[model samples]
Target chain A: MRTRTLYMGMIAALIVVVGLVGCSKKPPPGEIIPPPEVTPSEMPQTERVPGDETAPPGSAAEDAALQIEDVFYEFDKYALTARARDTLTRDADVLLANPGMRLLIEGHCDERGTREYNLALADRRARASRDFLVAYGIDASRLETISYGEERPFVLGSTESAWSKNRRAHFVVRQ
Target chain B: MKPIVHRFSIREPEQARAHGLRAGPFTVALLFWAGVLTVALLFCADAAAPEIDLHGTVVKRTLYRVPIVVEDFAIEASPGERNDPLFFSGGERPEDLLVQDLRFSDAFQVVRRRQGSFDPAGEPPRDIDGALVEQPIQARVVGRMEWDDERLRLKAELIDQGTGNRILDREVAINREGELARPDRWAIHRLSDEITRYLTGTPGCAATRIAFLRESRSGKELFLVDWDGYEEQAVTGLGTILVSPAWHPSGERIAFTSYHRGAPVLVALDLESRRLATLSTAPTPAAAVYSPNGKRVAFSTTAEGDAELYVARADGSHARRLTFHPDIDTAPCWSPSGERLVFTSDRCGRPQLFLIDADGSNLQQLTFSGEWNDSPDWSPAGSRIVHVCQIGGRFELALIDVQGFGWRRLTVGGGCENPRWAPDGRHVVFALTQAGVRNLWILDADSGNLRQLTASPDHSYNPGWSRPARERIRASG
Candidate 1:
């Protein structure tokens, strides 16, 4: 049993090394230099990328130079899915690498719920994502979230497809 | 919705002569107009959009269209020649008494248009139509008015917006001296009110209601009382921490938060049955409310971290967050049409109000004063929003127009919190804790009349008025 545990640990360490090696080979366009002896929790505010106070109406990656995936949640639940976890991972990486970058995680609900509850639930979802990012190492100070509740939907119809697209966490770039 | 009878006004005395009617005929016309007013007042019912009951029985969900009345400047006259003193005519004719009356009525929930500074009543001159208002609705009023002689004439029509059919077109006379010293030409005020009755089938809600919270024992209990401080009933018997009580659109149930059970949780209780159910439990107490369509509930919670907004079902399922701010983000209220929400946040420093589309895409800052401004409750007509604005030493209720202009104070008291609008949107109820005494108070939307509610001997707080139920049926517990 000790040998098997050791083997699993070795594999995990190898995966981390390979990932770091890949990062070094293809360092992102702008070299994000992490502060010496810096911890991940202190990364967001320290990396301080020039963020926009108001992001323009341009498509997803406009103001903060951060790319967020379409966060999807299971029906009747506000928990972030594996895909959402992976998407938020990108946000965590961006914050960890570029300390100046901040995120506004806006939570939304499908048109199926009540307005005030949806607002609270959307807020919870946004906080859920914010907590995940923080747990993974992003600075808490540089992040914010707001709940639009069910007031805002990505789709217009009442169909399941529209609801699926609506029950989501959207990333907004805040300067 | 046309007036039961229309009365023509006698102007220049010659016009009265033109009909070959003697001066004595004026009284007969006046009596007829009074009869019309009396009838209109008796039959006009609260005007709500025809319900389609699309989601009824299952949840028994029934949504009414936002009542919209389209009234322009005109002298509404009951055809024929005899002139009556009750026929209304004021500044710029129809723009005066009749138009203003339409805007003031309870049943129709009149939505008027802006005809520039030309409007006689000094109404904000902003269009009630256009992008400023949203929501699919059916109730509306359209009419016109004009002035002549020492008398003013009003020709007005109330029409259903969804269907361009004339609800009512009545001519009422306004006697200048008898009306001017009074309100909107007193003679015509009564007559136009009757016209409104014809349009709505229910008398006005002007002299009616207000629901607010009365704080006692340091903000412990929440009570509901009549607009005039009578029959006080505690909406919350938690005997613990409770605040922020709001009426559902239907006014049948109240949505609020209570901390009696340790953590703050959302709950809705049927006003008649007292059957209460817990929706969700949070680390701290927050505000919750039903959508305009009565489908969803928007609330605030701190379950994850700092306070933030969330949404869920009436039965408390499918919770989703709307904000991710680490700062205080609380109090969510839906616009009357349920397409948008206005809430309070400390994100921009002090507590200020903000609006977001129902889809969570468009975010806009609404209030500028850095002081604490929270608890936004939109008007039933979607024309205004009432909120609590706290200054250095003065806490007062404030009103902002739908266009976000014309921020005005509705109260100047020191401890007023959570301003809730009457169904007619012309009256507001709120909590006031002053001089170590806590009580609920009501304010008339126009005159700002003060009506204090000391309903109980206990330190009552947080009023959640059930909107006056239309049928007053025996609901379930």
Candidate 2:
């Protein structure tokens, strides 16, 4: 009975110590960037802000038209989830709407795996998005791909909430 | 023994303090007891099993550190020449560096004069019966340095105390040019390695170079430094993402993945010519490693929408796919014999190490314990594979034999990654993160001693230890 009590006490102490260490090691919260604009046809168009005076004509309109949502993946996985496929389907609609727009599909991963493996995984994630769009009738020539690996993280933390957002295929409409 | 225990106690509590936690003495004592219990259990479990000799095992073995008396080099001036102050007023003295190298080698422990004083340059005492005096020392090293015309010359000798025989005599000269025109400490490094080789039969790692990636605000770039982490030289400034820097067998070229042209590509850089060549055939290549013979290259590419292992000639011709997995298969490292490769793949549902023949036959899984394992580098002896294993949600360096019988974690406190073996096969250089700063560290495989090789503020990782220059010279000579 005494041994059991000591074991429980030790376990509780270990948990407390580990909790403190883990809390202290949390990466400082980074600048929170808004998620990519998901411009579904059913949604109301957002009002253009008043800072459009310095922009070229029609470029702002093109940027708004090319706004597509980013598709995310699980840890160390490149296979698109069902939600990811739906997002890419909507992304394909935006690509089809803007015929002159060329999309740069940027694959990114969280800071977890080895750099080399992460780079390759990121490439696969980007290519998966591109392949899905092409299969959805978007022209193959309209999309290009690049992998930032873990070098660029969308959200800078090791938590699952941040990692889920970081592991994604980000879209940038090239001019 | 007391010092060792004190070091452990201090290091553990200090690491806890670095986390901003107020670990009181009671907490520290509890933690130490917990650690001791855990280690005792592990040791008991591991000791119960008989040794397995499938490949070179990281199994615990008895360490025999040779006791040697090392003397400060006697500085000698050339006949009729002034003792130049220029030679003395340089960076690190040769004798100090030799002592540091000997200590770092872990094969010899320098006996302090307090233990038993002896004249290293003087002859040993002989009894009246023509027998040598009794001493605990096994060997002695003595050296002298003098200024030759345009170079500084160092002559060293290693004498065996037991047999009273001279084991080695060597001389090294360094030219006085480049970087303040100082006598290069590399001459001392060469002598240390020579002495170590003559005594231990295996070359020391002092005179080697490690290629690693240094991250900056712009991007990650390749940098080269000595084995002792001096003379930092930037090899590439592409201002783009670079990873997996690999040294060719000849130690004259480096291949790495670069995102210079908007896509990941395998690029080779010639150190002497400052030339870069892209292996254009590989689509989105990463983790390019040269074969043991330097005639072939194995790399991972995404030519078919999914990453797969591919092999080609060293010049990037006659490319052929070596794996047909739909799952992600990448980071292929060549075995010592170049007949097979050990790589990471997710075909097993999670990332695990898999070994396959060069012709893509007889594929087998090598690790099944870790949740994730990747970036395996085969040791030069073809016996062990060191890789990054995820334990407790943190990456640590782990070693496994070729036959997949043993699994051993080499580091603790996590944040260890990208392990590569030195040419000596007894030392491993890997990246370790502490207090949020990543630096390069070396692990003595035999002694399990960890030493930081680089402590830069910027992140440094992906270390590739090159063949020691002395070995190349000896091979050619």
Candidate 3:
């Protein structure tokens, strides 16, 4: 009778050990194993985050409160007109309202000139807008400029309407 | 055949006296007969033998297209081997590319075979028989393609039909086959170049490449494609605007202007290592071109407020401004001798091409008739310049001699820009835009024959042609 009791106890111990082994096979919740090491040459030089730099900052309500319209220019001209000045006035007011906010002025051109020349024209257009903002009491250091140079068109067409819409200084909010 | 007899008579006076015979009439008749026989024999020998003229004639020859026949390549497969997918899909075969190259080269008039038009199911004939030779096939090309596991072997031969002699024979191996793959195209291109070399004294541009700007989703990226527009690949993924790719003399690196850092900068990218090196850190640097020796670079920069031309070492050191005009000056191209530069400047109130020395001394205007002219590329031989001219509100390609003469228009309809010369100096590749679509086209500079090369959905422009890679390597070594 004592041997029979000891065999039952041994069987129970074996069952407990087996149960422990099976439970240990799987990892715990939210646990992760590291991946293999990769050589430096195999890694990408730049981690690209598409459209992140151009994305609008802050909550939806705050973004809605900031209204900075794009300024348009004449064909083959980078100088700002009266209407462009009015738009920059409003953009400068928005920048002044939020001290922590920064602005990226994107200069674009129509598809009517050489690519290299258009880039230079776009730079002048972006500087025109930025210069206007700086004159309207906005800090110069808070502004950054880039020229897309007929690469990204607001409207895809060759008509005057489309080209006029494409030749503009687009405003983007950054922090 | 003719035979003659010689006669002789004993006409001595002593002999006649001893025989007691008169020698007047008989001796005269024998002498006449002997003389006649000797003249007859001389005449016969002279008529039978060939004559030789001591003086020679000089003949002038002109260049003409060589006529050749490019037969459809045959596929050799075992009984149980599966046919190559490219053979039966009605797609571009290797021979088709070879024929296109031969035609585009303007060096040959390719004649086609009438019978056995590329049958993938039948066995390839061992030799080109008389029936196919009866056509206008002056020279014939016979090829055999076989498959072993994953590898493909191609054996091509160029035969002179008149002599039945093989002018060229080559074997090529390709490890993979796909629509986007390049090995098959490369192998066929190499073979085409060999055929061209065999027929003409100079090698063809089939093995060269062209670098251009292809519009992508994010921006314009630098892309490289074979001369035939077979292998198209993006070289720069900076996700920013890039343009004006200039191939180094070694054909291993390219210098281009990129906007990766929110401003224009000149960047050089090593093709093999896929590494990028910044050559210019100016606010707006564009139109970078390598010198003939590949030791210096000439580019246009806007860092000094107005756009001006600048020169620096190939590593972007010792930068010196070349143009000091307030107006825009850009699009710098080096002369073949690397002693002069042709650039587009607006100092005269409108954009026009100007010539300057390497040290920026000889500032002379090159173009005057056009209201706007830009993108001037000096010929490889340094005798002419091809640039884009705006006429009637449409940009067209125009060629001008180095002496500022022979201003001939090359393109007729549609807008064409950015004309680049092949290393052979006989062909020009430019971008043609029509109805808001842009494609690359090649033009035979001599015959003015136009052929479309690339049909990409995105716009392609600013083509830069490279020298033959093998020749460049040999030259560098």
Task: Judging by lDDT against the true structure, name the best candidate.
Answer: 2
Tens-digit per-residue lDDT, B62-133, candidate 1: 222234545455334454323543333222343444444444442333456543223333432233433233
lDDT of 1 by residue, A1-175 (tens): 7656655665575576556544443325564322123133322132332234555567443533546454777654667788888888887776676665677676778744223334555766877888898899888898776555554567866568988898888876664
Ranking by lDDT: 2, 3, 1
Pick the TM-score winner.
2
- Say which docking band candidate 2 falls in: incorrect
Per residue, candidate 2 scores C-alpha lDDT tens digits across A1-175 of 7656666777786677656544433323452222223224312223332223233556764665446889999988888999999888887887777676667788999888898889888988999999999999988998888777898887866678988889999887654
lDDT of each: 0.57, 0.76, 0.74
What is residue A62's positional error in candidate 3, in angstroms? 6.3
TM-score of each: 0.43, 0.77, 0.68
Worst 10 residues of 2 chain A by lDDT: A31-40
Cα-based lDDT at residue B442, candidate 3: 84
> For model 2, how does the per-residue alpha-carbon lDDT over B1-477 read when each residue is reduced to its tens digit?
111111233356677778888876567567757675565444444333322221222234446766677766777666444345546543446677777788788777665332224664566544222445444577877778777666677778888877878898877665555332234467777777887888788888888889999887778888888887776677676667787899898888899887666556787887766677776445678889999999999998888767899899998888899999888899899998999999999888889999999999999999987799998999996589999999888887888999996777876667788899988888899887754667888888777766778866568998899988765544211
DockQ of each: 0.01, 0.16, 0.05
- Compared with the true structure, model 3 gives a TM-score of 0.68
In model 1, what is the error at residue A3, expressed in angstroms? Answer: 99
